[model samples]
Target: MSEDPSLHQSHPDIIKRLKRADGHLKSVIEMIEAGRPCLDIAQQLHAVEKAIGQAKKTLIQDHLDHCLEDVVGPLPSDRRRTIDEFKEITKYL
Candidate 1:
């Protein structure tokens, strides 16, 4: 597993987003159990989805910006390796 090099900076923000999503997800579960309207449940679900998606995007981009630089340094060969690795990772997104 790859570790986040900018964990000090990005991890807090990512965790905050995920926590918000977790809260929204819990609300969604409650809404379903309480037989809430479909529209309200859908909206809460969308919020949870967006929060998670944004967190994932932020993490990947942060890794691309900070971690890649830290791991690859300034070497041209290492730069190619970073680019290749990034390309592979982006395929999942």
Candidate 2:
């Protein structure tokens, strides 16, 4: 199998954003433990979900630009598989 060129090419900004989101998630957990207001906890959870969606969008864009382009041409099976995987991912969104 050929090495994937985009495997380790994630942008640092994405990593930073993910780290911040992780911190937010931890804070949410702490809020729950501390018996914070239910509405406030729900708001934090919603924010985390939005952050995760944004991160997914960024990753999907990178995949389209790099990994998908690499496997799309001259390989019908690979192309179809990639399309199927993307469709599956969209179901979760």
Candidate 3:
């Protein structure tokens, strides 16, 4: 991490997305306890899964674009280091 204290520009949106997904997940649990139809449960689960996936992807892409750039962009001479950094970041995806 960054020594900077502020959240990244996209972080608020991601947090909102995750919170929405969390609500969806809680509803999913309720639906299951109530013995909802499988198709409906599956659809809600899919939505929750997709929301989380999108949030994760956005965070990683934002990190790669801004954070990694801040860390590596200054060292134009270090090709190998930049490549390694990119590789390291993508490992999570």
Candidate 4:
């Protein structure tokens, strides 16, 4: 299957967010090692989830802006199928 080129595009803000999330995850691991409180660890996990969700939303928006632009022309069927697949894959997010 052809890939969406927009999905491969890099954004500095997204990279920064991902790096922060990585650091948060590392902190979570350290907390667990140090026998930190369960509630505090859970809060960090939640923050990681929220950050990932935000990144996914940004990527989806970018895909719509770039890849979906040509989805309504002559090859509408193919484009619709591709979009349906994209939606299906993104549903788990």
Q: Which of the numbered candidates is closest to the native, going by highest lDDT?
A: 3
Give Cα-based local distance difference scores for all models: 0.83, 0.77, 0.85, 0.76
Q: Order the candidates by lDDT, highest first — what do you get?
A: 3, 1, 2, 4
Q: Which ten residues in a row have the lowest lDDT in candidate 3?
A: 71-80
Per-residue C-alpha lDDT of model 2 across residues 4-93, encoded as one tens digit per residue: 565545556678778888999999999999999999999999988888778877777677666665766555785678776874686465
- Top candidate on TM-score is 3
Write the residue-wise lDDT of candidate 4 on 1-93 in tens digits: 236454446455677788899999999999999999999999999999888778777777666656665564445686678866875676566
After best superposition, candidate 1 residue 23: deviation in angstroms? Answer: 0.5
- Ranked by lDDT, the better of candidates 1 and 2 is 1
TM-score of each model, in listed order:
0.72, 0.66, 0.75, 0.66
User: TM-score of the candidate numbered 2?
Assistant: 0.66
Tens digit of lDDT per residue, candidate 1, span 56-86? 9888877777766676667678557868787
lDDT of 3 at 52: 99
Count the clashes in each prediction: 0, 0, 0, 0
Candidate 1 deviant stretches above 4 angstroms = 1-6, 75-93
Task: Give me candidate 1's TM-score against the actual structure.
Answer: 0.72
